[model samples]
Each structure stands twice: as C-alpha cells, then as structure tokens.
Target chain A: MNWHLIAAQLLNGLALGSILALVALGLTITFGLLGLVNFAHGVFFMVGAYAGFVTFQYTHSFGLAVLMGALVVLVVGIVVERVVIRLFYRRPPEDQILVTFGLAIVIVEIVRAIFGGKTQLFPMPSWGMGATNLGFLVYPNYRLQVIVIAAITLAAIYLVLYKTRLGLIVRAGIDDSLIVNILGIDVTKTLLAVFVLGAMVAGFSGVIDAPIVAVDPDMGASVLIESFVVVVIGGLGSFSGSILGGIIAGEIISITTIWAPDYAQVMLYLAMALVLILRPQGLFGTEGRL
Target chain B: MMLRAIGDRSTWRVELAVAVFLIAFPWVFPIIGGYANLATRILILGLFGIGMDLIFGYTGMLSFGQAAFYGTGGFVTAYLLSTGMLHNTLGALAAGTIAAACCGMIIGYLCLRQSGVYFAMLTLAFGEVFYFLENSPLAKWTGGENGLPGLPKPVIPLGFTTLHVQSNLALYYFVAILFFVGYWVARRIVRSPMGAVLRAILENPARAAAVGHNVPKYKLAVFTIAAAYAGIAGGLLGIFQGYMPPDAFSIDQSGEIIIMTIIGGAGTLIGPLVGAGLWSYLREALQNLHGVGAFWKLILGLLFIVLVTLFRRGITGGITDSIGLFRVRRRTAAAHVEEAPAVSGEVQP
Candidate 1:
C-alpha cells in the first residue's frame, strides 16, 4: 500500500482505538472493582448515545448534550445497582451476568419501541465537522478530535484512579474488596461512585461515537464485544494495558481490512481466541483469576 | 408397605400420561390452537432451548454463540441438499450436526479457560464473527444476508414405500418425531453420571476440580453436545420452514433461547420445551392482536424481567414445586393416621 493509504488507515485505527479505550475503561472498572461482568454496560452506552442524540436536538449544543447524556446514564446505573445488581453482588457471577443480560434486553427493546428500529443520525458539531489534510494523507476532523478527547479522558481516568482517594479505594477494591473493608473504610459509597463513574465513561464514549456510527438501539451490542477484546488484551483493571490493547485491536481491524475487508471482524475474534489460548488472564492481566 | 407401593405406581402413571400428551401434541394442537405451523415452530425453538439449558443451566456457562453453530449447521445442510450433493436428507442433517459439534470443540477449547463474563463475551465475539462470515465472504456458500431459500423437505426410504415428508402437516410430523427423540436423549443425558458432574461444576468448579473430576473436559463435552443439539434443531428448522433465514445467526436467536430456557425453568429437562412453547405462542398471539407490531418484543422483555424477578425457578419448576408440596401434604396426613393407633395403644398402657 502507498504511504498515504497507510497513513489514513493509521488515523482510522486511532479513532477506533479511542472508542475501544473509552468502552474498555467502563468494563475495566466495574469488572476490576465490583467483580461483576455488567453485561448491560453496552446498553448503558446505547442509552447515553440516544440521550445525547435527544439532548442535541433540543439544545443544539454538543457539550450540553454530552453532560445530559452522562448524567442520565449515571442515574440509570445507580438505579440498576440499587434494584438488581446489589442482590447479585453476593451470588454467583453467572447469576449477575444473566440478570444484566436480561436487563440489557429490556433496555434495548424499550429503546426500540420508543425510537423505532431505524438508525438515528447526529451531525458532528461545527468544530469537529471538517477534514484535516496532512502532507501525506487526509483525515476526518471529527476523528482527530476523537483521538484528542480520548487521550484527555484516559489521562483524567488515570488521575482519578491513581491520584485521588476514590481511585485508591477502587484500586484497593480491585486488589481485594475484603481487605478494603477490613481497613475500616466505607467501601459501599466507593462502589456506588465507581459504578456511576463507569457509566459516565461509557456515556462519554457513546456521545462521542454517535456522529461516526449510526445511533440505533442495537448499536451497543457489537461495541460491547469489541470492548471485551480490549479489556482482555490490555489486561483487566490495568489502565495502560487498556490503552495498549485498544490500539492493538484497532490496528488489527484496520490492517486486516486492507487484506480482506469482509474478514476484519472475524479476524478480531480469532485474535482474541488466540490471545485466550496464550494468556487466559489477558496480555497485561495478573495470573490466577481465570 | 401398601402405601409405598401405591405411591410408586402413581408416579409412573403421571409420567406415562405426560409422555402420551407430548406424543400427541402435534395431532391435537391444531384442533385447539388453530395454527399447526406455530406449534411446529415452537417445537423447533424448544429443541434449541433445551441445548442452551444444558450449557447454561447445567454447566453454568452462559454462551452467546449458540446461534453461530445453529447458522453454520443450517447453511451447510441447506447448501449441500439444495446443491444436489447430498441426496439423503438424514445423512445431510447428521453431517450438519457433526460439523457444528466440531465448531463447538474449537470455540470451547479457547473459551473454556476463561470463566464467567469473559467467557460470555468471547462467545459473543465468535457469534458475530460467524455472522460476518455468513453475510459477506462466504455468501456464495451461505447465501449471504437473505439466507438460503428453497430448502427441500427430507424424504425417507421405507424399502416397501418411500415417504415424502412434505407440507406443513407432514413436516410437523417429522419435526415432532425429532423433538420427541431429542427430548428423550437429552433426558437420558441429564440423568447420566456425566450430568451429575456437570451440575457439580455449576455448583462449585473448585470443588469439582478438587474432587478429581476433569472439569474442563466435562465442560467441553457438554458444550459440544449442546452445539450438536443446536445444529440438529437448526437443520430441522430449514427443512420445516423450507427456508433458512439469516436471522438464525443473529444475536436475537441466541437471546431467544436464553429467554426461553429461563422462562420455562432451567436445570429441568423439559423446562426449555415448555418455555419455548409459551414464548412462541405468546409472541404469535400478541402479534396478531391489533396495534402490536414491534411492541411485541418490548412486551416480552417486560415479561422476562418480571419473571426473573419473581419466578427465578421458571414456570416448569414452579409447577413442579407446587405439585411436590401437594404430594408432601398427602404423605404427612397418612403419617398422622398411622401414628394415631400407636398413640392410642400407648395411652391405654
């Protein structure tokens, strides 16, 4: 391939990578701290995207739309935790997974009933609408914005997880929730906050991704699976690993598309399967969990 | 001694009555429900649900990839039979089931290592991958998004006469027979030692492992068995409907099986069949009701959530428990009567 095409593919890879990072971050925290799979996280993402779409129609302001979307999703997440998920925390992981799976179906079906099954469109805001032409290649302006936003968000999350007390508790919970409780800290509030934060992160991803992909009730289904690959590749709960995994998956999809466009998605699963064979806990994950 | 003998005989009688009802379901349903096509569809879906129940209910593995094998087996059989390569329908269907089992082995090998949600996600990836393959690259073989149409009905050579298993009534008979056979086989599997081990794994993998059971092997075996059952059921769908739609590979297909199993009662052999019958019947009935176009799925979702919240044991399990309660009450009453004479003798002394 020519350098221009390669460069374009690289940029596309970055766009996909950014989305993966955002989604994986949502999964990483919930899985890392709460030890719950949260199969409905994808539904949360869809809800956020749909909320953003609605908000944008009303206010015509992207920032306002994102804030509204994130807030709505945050509330939904907390409500789910209080009603269904809290009961699952003490049960088997499979029960939590199935319950969330059922809840996801409910959420998606509700959205479909309300919005109809057709794909809904959201225009990229004026600031992120145009293309940027490099000397070697041209790239979508919105995609470039996604990269910048993702970097900032990733850094922000890193700070929240590493520097802040909440982050410390989450990290502690990740290592061992029992130990965190033994330390006489209020782990309950920490869990509730982390659940909300995870939902917000997913919400952010949804808002950002709405313009690039068609916003539909079933939109989150595929993205949810891809995010799983990222989490597995990057190592669950490892911040840097998520970034690395996201990039690797993005490149895998983009580069494979060059060879066989149809096999791009299949190849990603094959890659995940291979990874599972080689490292069951994932690339950067600690051993023994699996 | 007489009471114990009577109890055993009554249990056998109930089982025999249930078996007779299932055997006559196809012949009798049309008279009651006014739609035999719907009943056949329910049976096909029920068979698929039984396979899923084995994996999720017994083995404790929640897979989202059952549809992958279903689609693969279906398309393969359809292509072969339609292309004139495989003349014998039974042979072609058997090959399809075996092929799906092979696919299951490959997927299970990679996925079984990762337990819980990760395994579920991985299966989802595999399912999507298979869907993509069927949609684009292998469209020539799979017939792409439209799916393979013109699937022929199976014919059996009875030596004395050839029986053409065609039309709704005939296909209904064919599918009903297979459903019964599949149900019988699955029941046997559930009652076998392997089934007990699978239940053990579901209860506690660590304990199962510590107890010297090859947990992974059992998991893989059960997964393959489930895939085989899914494959056969899928093949029957193509033969029954005369068309294999791409929707078979959709996430909805996998989700439908999960919902059917949960709604019917997991861990019980007949739960999925009952669940499938209820779900399919409800959907058809609701759809036919005016002003319920796409809202039917939404209504079902609400129903599912309510069921999960209230009837975690599902319909079949709930009924079984109620029946069990009644039986226990009768037995306790008999025990009270038996004790009365002994108490009177003690009072006299």
Candidate 2:
C-alpha cells in the first residue's frame, strides 16, 4: 500500500465522517428524545443547502449563506414538527413512517419543481479556494475548513448536551421518562427544542458541504440513509456511538474507494449488514433502548 | 342498503361490478379524457399494492422495499424478452417472478430477523443495495439507468389457433385478466389458514406466538408472498410498457405503492385497486390543472398529510366506518351483536 495515497484517503474519510457525524447527531437526539424516526430530516439538510443557495444569490457572502441556510431549515423544522409531525407522536410507527415518507417525497418534488432537474453549484470562496499543504497530503482548503467548522459545532453540541441543564433533562428523560414526568419538567418542549436543534445541525452540514458536491432536490437522501446507518451502527440512543459509527462509515467508504470505487458505496451496506448480524442493538446502543 | 351491500362482502356482487367496470374500461376511459394505458397502469400497480397490503395492512409489517422484488422481476423478464432468449412471454415472466420469489427468501430471511421498525429499515437498506447494483456493477446486463427495451407482445396459443394481443385495447383485456386472476388468488390466500395466522400476527404477535403459531415463519412467508406479487406486477410492468423504466427499483415506487394501498384502505383486498385508481386519477388531474403543473406533488403531499391525519383508515376504510356508524345508530332498537369490520380491507389488523 502506498502510504501517501492511504493518508489522502484517510483524510478524505475524516472529511466524510464529519458530515455523517453532523447529520447523525440530529437523528440520534430526535430518535432518543421522541422515539420518532425523522425521515424528513434529510430534506431539512437539502432545504438548508437551497436556503444557502438562495441566500448566497443575494448576500454573496459564504458565511451569510451558511447562516441563512441553517436558520431557514431550523424554522422549517419547527413548523413541520408543530403542524405535521406533532400529530404522529401518538400514532403508530407505521403511520409515522407513512407521513414522514410522504413528506420527504413532497419536499423533494417541490424542490425539483422549483429548481428544475439541474444541479445547483456553489463555488469555493476566494479565502478558502486553494489547497492546504499538509506535507504528505495536500488537501482542499475548504474541506479542511469544513472539518474544523464541523468539529467546533460538534464540540458545541457536546457541551450543550453534557454540561447544560437542558442536556441533563434530555438524558434523564431518555433513561426514565416516568421520573422526568414526576419531576414536572416540560419534556415535550425540551424534545421539540432538541428536534429543532438536530434539524439545524443537519441543515448546517448541508449548507457547509454544498460547495463540494451537487446541490439537488434529492441530495439529502443518500446522506440521510448513511446517517441512519451511522446511528444504528454507533448505537441508536448513544451520542458517542453516532460519532464512532460515523467515522467507521466514513473510513469504509473512503478506504474501499482506494481498492474499488464502485464497491465503496456498497461497503456501507455491507457494514450495516455485518453490524445487524453481529450486534442488532448496534455497537454502542443499549439492548432495550430501541 | 348501500352500506349493507358494501359492509357485507360475502357476495360476488362487488367482484362482478369490478369485472364489469374493467371490461368496459378501455372503451369508457377514452370518452372521459383517459386512455387504456392509464387504466392498464393502474391495474398493474393495484396488483402490486394488493401484495404490499398483505404484508403491511393485514400482517402489520411496514416493509419499505417492495421495489427490490419489483425491479428484479422487471429486469429479469425484460432481459430475457429483449435478448430473444425466451420465446414465450408467459414463460419469461414466470422466470422473472420465480427469480424474485427466490430472491425474496434470502432477503426476507435477513430482514425478518428484526421486527417492527428494524425490519422496515433493513429492507430499505437491502432494497437500496439491489438498486445500486442495478445502476453500477450489474449495469452491463441490466442496462444501468438506460433500462431494457424491445420486448415482444404476448401470443396466446388457443389450441392450434393463436391469439395475438398487440393494440392498447387488446392489451387492456390481457392485463385485466391477469389482474383479476391475481386478485382472486390473493383473496383465496387471505381466507386460508395461513391468512388467519397472518392476521393474528398483525393484531397481536406476542399472543399469537404464545398460542402456537410460528410468528417469524408467518412473517417470512407473507414477506416472500408480497415479494412474489411485486415481482409478477413488475414483470407485467415491463410487458405493459414494452420497455422497463429504470425507476422500477426506485424508493419512489415503493412509496407510491404504499400510498395507493393506504389511500384505498389497507387490509382491504380491493382497497389498493381503489387507491390506485384514485391516486393515478389524482396525479393526472393535478398535473393537468392549469396553475398546478409541477406543483401537483406538493398538493399531493399536503393531501397525504391530511389523509393520514384525518382519515386514518383511508378512503375505503373511512367509507365503511361511516356506514358502520350509521348501522349502529339505526339498528339501536335491535340487539346489535355482529360488529362491522373496522377497515375496508378484510385482512387489515
């Protein structure tokens, strides 16, 4: 194996892992808090990119684009949870899947109808346009920036979850909802806040990554599936599990590309299958949590 | 009387009415700004939805990957027919259906291990794997995104005389017959011992298992059966269009079928057909609306949300439940013993 190429692929894997980590973070929080699989969470990501796309059209500032994208999606997340998804809190899982799946379709189709079938482009900013010199591996400067930004955001989330009273209540709710209810904490409100936070992070990731890839109606789909896979692999209810699973998923995709590009995509599925077979609860997930 | 007629489906009147409507569809559709092709498409899709309903509505397994078997059947049969490897159209279709069923067993074995949400997610994963395979590695034979084309129409040998079905009108009859037979056969399965077991599993699997019925086995069987139905429907799709579109394996197809099944009423044997009819009609109608155009999906999405929110039992279920309510009100003077079925579909849990 060429050490230089391996290093490049490994770096690329970390880059990919960061995005998965961002998306999976939202999924895990929402799933843990609400016991609802937000299928439309991916659409939030797509809308965020589009939100960024539209914002960039007027502002012409990359930072502004990211901010606007995240904010728009955050509002979208809140409204959607309020009107549509709020009803599903008491509905059966099957109905929940249907409503969200339908919402996903609607969102994708609306985006397509508005944007047409063409891929939207977002260029790398002049400040971060060039490659970064890392002795053995020269990486795209914007990707490096993305990594740092993602890490900072992740750290912020980790601190909020671990340090804040809200975070404590969230953890407490997951462990013992009955006690949390007895304690008179507004669990529903906190869950809504958590869900919206998750959506904002997902949207932030989308807007941040928009410059690197095609921005289209269904762009969030594969990312959404992968994030779910990461959550499952990392352990559905565990925060650290999502991070670990995201890295493993990112590495698998990137490493497989070195040997065979086509199989790189398939490798995620293989990993998921293997995980399900070996440990159905996932690596970090509690057995009874799911 | 109308409610009673609909509520009590023991008679063949409903089937007869359906048969009559189908027989007249090709001719009737043209006068109403519709075509035989649309009707044909609805029937084929309805056939597929019926199978999905068996798993989801009746058996309470919300599998999100019916498209795998569907695409498998389409590609297999499309390949054979286009390559001239299979002369008999029915034989090629059978080959495709059988291959899909076989594929179902393997996929089902893995997916059914995890019940509830896990099964649905696992199926989505595996189903997507098949889709990726279609687009990438298996692209050479499957034609990747381009899909297979140039399939010959059916030629039925009627005891030394052959009947060639080519025109849209003739094709409607051909497809209708197949749909009717499929529906009839499905109805039989729903009435069998296995069907009872499946319903038990749907309503209460834990209790059902404790009562000596093998839960996993039934789940696997129904999953495989659903796949077979999806497979046959897919083969028919290729044969119907003469070219199998690449979207057969798409997540959209799976979603569409589920929507149709739900809209028409899950658990109802004919609910999917009703749902397909309504869904297709709506799709065409919304697209044709002057201001809507591309916004039809947005409207439909809103409609789906509204439907799931208000009409939990769907169109057919809603209608029957209303009738059931009316029956209860009017028959209050009499001793009410027999309860009206909750869902329009007999198999619905």
Candidate 3:
C-alpha cells in the first residue's frame, strides 16, 4: 500500500542487481559459448575479491584494487584452463561440473587456510561514500555508482563481444561450435579467451561488491547459485538475457525480503521452476538449447 | 548361468567374501588403527552411496539434493523419539524412510522434467529449501539449530531373554546386520529388470525411450528408491550418534557423499563402502595432523582433482579393469605355449 516503500525496494533491487548483472555476464558467456556450467566461477569471484582486498591494503586505491582483481583472476583462469579445464572440454557436462567443483573446493579451501574463517572488511572509498538525493528518494552514493559501473561494464563487454573480430567468432561460435571449428578459428584459443574474460568480470564483480557484503572465503557460493538461476531465467547464453534475468531476480529477492525474508530464496527458486516448466530454453534462450 | 543372461549372477562367492570381511572388519580394524565407530559410519555411508549410485551411476541423473531426504528422514525419526511418540525404534525408522521417499516422489515429479545441469540445480535448490524449512519453519519439532538429542536405543526381545542395543559395539552389530540386508536388497534391485532399464537409461536416454522404455518414469522410480536409501542412512546416523544434528540436510553432507561415491567408484555397489572408509580415514588423519587446522579439505580437493582427471572411474573400477587385463594376458600366454607344442610335434613327423 505504501508507494514510497515500493519505490525504495525497487531502488534497492537495482543496487543489488548491479552486482548480479556483472557476474551473470561472465556466466552467460561461459554457458552460451562453451556449453559449460562452471561451478568454480564463484571461486574466481572470491579470488578476485582477495586480489582487490590485498591491493587496497597496500595502495588504498579502489580503481587499482579492481584492476588487480581482474588481472589476478584472468591469469588464474588461463592456468586452470590449461591444467584442469582443457582436459574436460571434450568430456561430459557432469565431468566438467565435477572437475570445476573440485577446483572450487581447492580454491576456497586454500583461501580459507590463508585468511582463516573470519569475514574481512573492505571499506568503500570516501568518494564513493555518502548519499544521493533524487527529490523523492535518497540513495547511497556507492550504490548509485554501482549502477553506473555495471551499465558501463555491460556496454564495454557488449562492444568487445560484438564489435571485435574475436567477439564475432565468439558469437558465431555460440551458434554452431562445429561449423566454427571447421572454419579454422582455433576454437580452443577462442574459448580460452572467453573463459579468461568471463573470469575477469566475475573477479571484478567480487572486488566492486566487496564493500557492500563481507569479504569471506565462502561468499561466492550463494552468489554462484543465484547466478545460475539468473542464467536459467534469462536464457542460458544470451548476454542481454542474463542482464534482464539478473535485474528480475534482484527485484524478486529484494521485494520479498520486505514481507517475508525467509521466503525470498524460496520465491526465487519457485520463479525459476515456473520459468523452466513454462519455457525450458528461458526467455531469451534459443529453442532446443535446453 | 541362467541369471547371467539377465545380468543377475548370484555372485555368492563375492558376497561371501564381503560377509567374511564385514565379520572380520572389527578385528582387523583395530590392528589397522581403525575403530568401531568408523566402521559403523562407513556402513551407513555405504548404504546411502548405493542409493546415490542407483541415481547418479545407474540412471545417469546427477542429483545434488540428496541431503534433503537425509535430513527429512533423520529429523522425522529423531523428532518421533524425542517426543516419545515412537516407542519402537524400528517402526520409527521405517516411518522416517517412508517420509523421505514421499518427499523424493514429490520433488522428483517437478525435478525429473529437467535434464542434465538443470536437474542438478533444481535438486540443489530444493535441498536448500528443505534445510531452511527444517531450520526456521519446523524448528519446534526438528529442534532448529540445536537438533534433537537423547534418543532411546532399541531393544530386541528373544523367546527367553531380551537384548538392549545401547553401546557402540552393540549398535555396530545392529547396524552391520541392517547394512547387510540393505546391500542384499540393493544387489537384488541391481539384478532386476528395472536395474537393466536404469543402466540403459544411463547409457543413452533418447535411445532408451525410443526403444519403448519410459525413461522419465524409471528415473522417478530410481530417484524414489535412492531417497529411501538416503532416508535409512539418515535414520541410522541418529541411532548411531544418539543425536540427530541439523547438518544432515547441509550441502556439505551431500557433497561429501558425492565425493565418497566417486572415489569408491560409481556403478559398483561396494564402491561407497570403500570410499567412505577412505574418506573418513583421510579426514581423521588430516584433522589429527599438527599444523593443519582446517586445510585438510585442500588435500582432499587436490586428491579429488587428480582422481577426476586421471582415475575418473575410481578405485573399484581401476581394480576390476586391471584384474580383467591380467586374466586376458594369462589366457593368451597359455594358448601360445599350446601352439608351440603342436608345431614341434608336426615338424618331427
């Protein structure tokens, strides 16, 4: 009944969704291009957060932290692709899941071993702090910044994926991997780049959002599961689909928190279940992809 | 020979060997630095693993929500006992199992419609939902975070005397008997026509359905069966520990079960027992080791990576493969010697 409350919740949803949008872009690419559901993607997010955390400790620069986070995860992704994931490219989806799952465990456990089980604080830069006034609303300055950053990131990624030659092949590759392979595109290299790009954004999301949520080793798990939900709802591989899915999931979770907090997760799951039942391929997913 | 056509060879020799091992386990265990409790834990996991194999290995359905059924059954039995509603332990355990199976049937109805990763994700979501429900909504009966404790041990009455299964030793024997029964039943199921149908589904779902088999229906059936098995294992956990913790429904529990199943080998029924034993031993050893506080998981993770990449079929599969190879080599060698003797005699003539 309270219009203001609804508006506030909507705004809150946007802030929360910005983080998910960033993460989902990478998930969409991996799922869309490689036909993989990388469970370890979340681990990369955590690793990125640590990368940012350490950079901030030394340099006290948020921008530097974000860059370090991205760079660290990119390098890690390359090593993982070569050492572990490349072997699974030809294997079944389950094998890929299990391998990545094992990798996730290793990454998380190593982080935990180093950091212990405590949650670390990542302070928002002073410039990104404080509140913004919009006549009818007052929102945190950091959150508003998150919305803009997420938008910019999406635009950049969009351009990279569509405008660049490699991006075109990536998109075309999504259409038909076999055909793309026959074209002598070095599908392996292309997929490796895609994986690295995906990991970078995931790490960036972790660094950017670390200020909002506690930086913990196991922080990536819930986010990872929710991201999967987003991908499923948006259609598995469509970039725009995940973006839309992320916003919707954020709104559903944020709005439900007002009435019944416990039911929020349940509602998100129910929404996904309904989507799967009604449209298996998702809202933007190609038919038969399911 | 008659049963071999249906993939139902009795394999009494193997069964007898296992029975002997189970009987001799307690004696050999102490010598190997193992304990009674560890054996009991292994047997329970073995039971649960068999059910997991039915779904994951036999039916080719990767479910990540088995802990839901486990928690459901464990809580049901624990709640009944805590409230004094169930006097007979066996009856309570049976009730708990039925409850878990019913849940599986309902969850499977919605989940089975999705295949591959989606199926796994849906199950994971449902499992988390159950955990939240048990934690917040049904906390009154399930004991929330503290969990239900102080459960009464079961008593068996003989014609002239009554036996109380209370101590760890007694519980081990009781559990061992149940484990044997469970294994026997699982073996029967694996040999049944339904098991063949399941394996067929695992091999190729589209082909299995095209050949007039109802793949989804079979999937649901095996899914329910697995839930029942998990339910029993959950109930046994409460009985063995004398308390049922809410952790039975956790993702970690499900993950551990998956790890154990994989390490032991998936398709083989005995794989779980071996896996559980190995995992538990590793855990105990790692936990007790100095300088390693919580990083034992890292070691296990490394082992998991190696196994997944190099030894995907697992310990049991590896053993069986090598054994088969050895037999083939011996047979070929014998045939070669026989040919040499025949050639020499012909040349002399």
lDDT tens string, model 1, A1-290?
47777788888988998889889888889888988887888999999999999999988999998898899899899998888777777656666777888889888988888898899888888899878887667788999999999999999999999999999999988988999999999877887888888888998899989989969999988888889888888887777778888998998899888879999888887888778888878888888764
TM-score for each prediction?
0.93, 0.94, 0.93
lDDT of each: 0.81, 0.82, 0.83
Residue B272, model 3: lDDT of 77
lDDT leader: 3
Per-residue C-alpha lDDT of model 3 across residues B1-349, encoded as one tens digit per residue:
1111112233675566667777878778887678999988988998889889889866778888999999898889888876788877787889999999999998898888788877877787778778878887677788888888988887655659777897777788888888888877887787678977887677677777998999999999999999999998999899788899999998778878888888887777787788888898888878887987477889888888888788775777566555544443433522321231122113221
Enumerate the chain B TM-scores of all models: 0.88, 0.90, 0.89
Per-residue CA lDDT of model 1 for B1-349, tens digit only, reads: 0112113225445345546765677677766564778878888888888789889877779898899889878887888788878877887889889998999998888888887777888888788888898999999888898898887778777779878876777777788777778876776686668977887777667778998999999999999999998998888888777788888899889888988898887766577877888888778777878888567777777777777666766777666655554565444523322231122113221
True A-B contacts kept by model 3 = 0.52
- For model 1, the stretches where C-alpha displacement exceeds 4 angstroms are B1-18, B27-34, B328-349
The C-alpha local distance difference test score for the whole of candidate 1 amounts to 0.81
Q: Return the clash pairs for model 2, or none.
A: A235-A285, B267-B345, B267-B348, B268-B345
The chain A TM-scores for the candidates, taken one by one, are 0.97, 0.96, 0.97
Q: Count the backbone clashes (under 3 Å) in each candidate.
A: 0, 4, 0
The CAPRI category of model 1 is acceptable
What is the DockQ score of candidate 1, to 2 decimals? 0.48
Clashing pairs in 3: none
Interface RMSD measured for model 2: 3.3
